[model samples]
Each structure stands twice: as structure tokens, then as C-alpha cells.
Target: MTLYKIDEVASECNLTKRTIRYYEEIGLLSPQRSEGNTRLYTREDIERLKKIISARDVLGFSLQELHRYIEVVEMLTGQRERYRSITDLEERRRQLEEIDDTLGKQLDMMESKMRTIQSFKEEAEQLRQQVREGMERLGRQSVERAEAEH
Candidate 1:
């Protein structure tokens, strides 16, 4: 198993060392520790950090929301792993239902954020249209004034 120190992980993940530490502090990450108490990260840890960054920067998730999102994702991951081992049809069906429910929660969060972003985009478009109209009105008034002077 390959392990990396914090600096390597931070550089690879495009995050600062402090940010990685903060993520660990906030329960967003849990890297292993070395014999001297230094943080050691695995490839999985780097992937998780990337997910966190995407949720934060792309999805505009608040820390609280990100936490919940990560929780659901982790739960779903575990459920998927457990699903492969079970042979009972009823148990597999139940596991599938749980996975579906977990997926629904993630979808809900994304849909809520999308709705908020869509509203903001609409407001911006409205403002842009208003400004365009105002500019055209002013241009017409200036033209009329010039024509009167001529």
C-alpha cells in the first residue's frame, strides 16, 4: 500500500496543507498517522478531497451541506460493498432500496442548489435586460436632442 505525506497530498489535490488539516479538523477527512504522528494519505483520501473541493467550489455547498453530502455518499458506498456479498433476494432488494434512498438525498441537495443558481441567473439576466433598455432609451433621447439642435 502506497502512502503519502500531507504535502504531497495537498499538491496533488490542489489544496493547501492548512486546508487539508482544516478538513481533517472539521471531520471531512481522516488520514492515517505515521509513527512520528505525521499525516499519511492514501489514493482514496486524495479522491475524497477532490470530491470535497468539487462539492465546495462547483456545487457551492456550504460546509454543513458538504458534510451531509459526504455522509450519504459514504453510506451508499458501504451499502454497495455489502450488497455484493449478500445472496438472499429479499436482503438484496432491501439494500437496493436503501441505496436508492441515499441517492435520492444526494439528488435533493443538488436540485436545491441548482434551483438557487437558476434563480440567480434569472435575476442577472433581468438586470442585464433592464440596463440594455435604459441604454437604448438614453441613446434615443440623445439622438432626438441632437436632431432638435440641428
Candidate 2:
């Protein structure tokens, strides 16, 4: 049962001490303390912290979403360990599938919005050209009026 201090774990994971502390404050990691009240992190804790960072920063999971997954898994198992129940895993899989569907819908919406914006830009350019032509015609008419009056 080898344990690492906060600094050692942070250096090993290429993360800053402040980031690790913040994760702890956010209920992500929970390291134990020695008899002298020094924080001692286990290998399991390190693995969980690494997973959280990877899921959030690398995989683009929001903190709230990742926390919800972790909480459900933990609740099903009642352990600070990986989940084991078949039913719970199935439920998680279903939830993930729903998330995928929702993301697909959002992507379709974004594409539609992009098309609309592009159309608006084209219309604006055409309107600008028309305004320029109108101004030039008005200038020519004004010159003709001034010459006739002279």
C-alpha cells in the first residue's frame, strides 16, 4: 500500500498542485491523511484523478457530466472502485447513447445556423452594392440638374 504525497502525485501526473487541490475541493479526488495530518494519495486515487482529467480536458466532458457519471457508478457499487453491476452498466450505456443523439441534433442545428448566416451575409453584400449604385445615379442626376440650372 504505497502512498504518495500531493507534490509527488502532481509531478507524476504532469499536473499542478493547485489543480489537484481544486479537484479535491470539487469532490473529484479524496486523499487520505497521515497521522501527522499530511495528505497521502494512493495509486487508486491517482488513477481516478487521471481518468477525471482525461475525460474532462481530453474527451471534452463537462465537469458536471463527468461528476454525474462518477456519482451514479459509485452509488451503484458503494465503493471507491470501478463499477461492477450489469444493470448499472447498461443504464450508463443507454444514457451515453442518449447524449450522442442529443449531440447529433445540436450539430444539425449549428449547420442550419451557419447556412442562415451565410445567406444573410450574401444578402447584405447585395444590398450594399445596390446602395452604392443608387448613390452614384443620384450624384449623376444632381450634376445634370446643376448644369441645366446654369
Candidate 3:
């Protein structure tokens, strides 16, 4: 149940204080506030920030995409909560089946996105290697020309 101040959160998450505040503004975070109006971050906030960083920096998902994903997550969470209130065994089983199907599709969609991002990374690496080879060749040619001139 430990809480962190904004500074602590920024340091722990490797983000600027402004960036953390901006995330709150954009609905990516919802830190509680002290009586003095200072932002108070819980352990859940820290974990969520890590996820956000990975989603943005590693997966290359834009803020809008993150927002949309959050919406889908919240919707799914609500659906799961509804199962707790269901009393009839048959109805619960039906709801559970629906949840399983939806979860599978969501996982598939995430896998597809990861594959696409990996493709882009591979392409960039190949381009980088080609550029490096070209630069090395040019440097060698320049040196050869200089020796010949001498």
C-alpha cells in the first residue's frame, strides 16, 4: 500500500515529471492526490506506467492506439465483472464461453501487431547493415585514392 510522489514515479519509470502529468491528462494514468494536491502514485500506477512505456517504446503504439486499447480493456473488465453477478449456471456457462472467444480474438490481434512491429524492426536492421557497408566501402575507396595521389 505504499504510495509514491510524482518525482518518485518519474524516476522509477524513467520519465519526466511533465510526461507523467501529461499521461494523467491523457487518461493513461489516474494517480490519487494528496490534500496539498500533489499526485500520489500507488504500486498499480508504477506497473501501469511500465506497461505504457513498453507499449509505446517497444511496440511503437501511438497514444491514440493506447487510448483505444485501454477502452477495450475496460470494456472487457466490465464484462468479466458481470459474470460475478450472474446466478443461473447455464447463463454463466454461456457468458464464460463468450468471454473465452473474445479473449482469444484479442490475443490474436495482439500477436498480429507484434509480428508487424518485428517485421519493421528486421527491415530497419537490414537497411542499417547495408548503409554501414556502403559507408565502409566509400571510406576505403577514399583512402586508396589518397595513397595513389601521394
The whole-model lDDT of each prediction reads: 0.95, 0.74, 0.86
Quick one: best TM-score, which candidate?
A: 1
lDDT of 3 by residue, 11-90 (tens): 99899999999999999999999999999999988988887898778656789877766655666777799888999999
Superposed model 3: Cα runs more than 4 Å off? 81-87, 118-150
Q: For model 2, what is the C-alpha lDDT against the true structure?
A: 0.74
lDDT of 1 by residue, 1-150 (tens): 899999899889888999999999999999999889999999999999999999999999999999998998899899999999999999999999999998999999999999999999999999999999999999999999999999
TM-score of each: 0.97, 0.50, 0.65
By descending lDDT, how would the candidates be arranged?
A: 1, 3, 2
TM-score rank, highest first? 1, 3, 2
Residue-pair clash count for candidate 1:
0
Best by lDDT: 1
Model 1 spans with C-alpha error above 4 angstroms: none
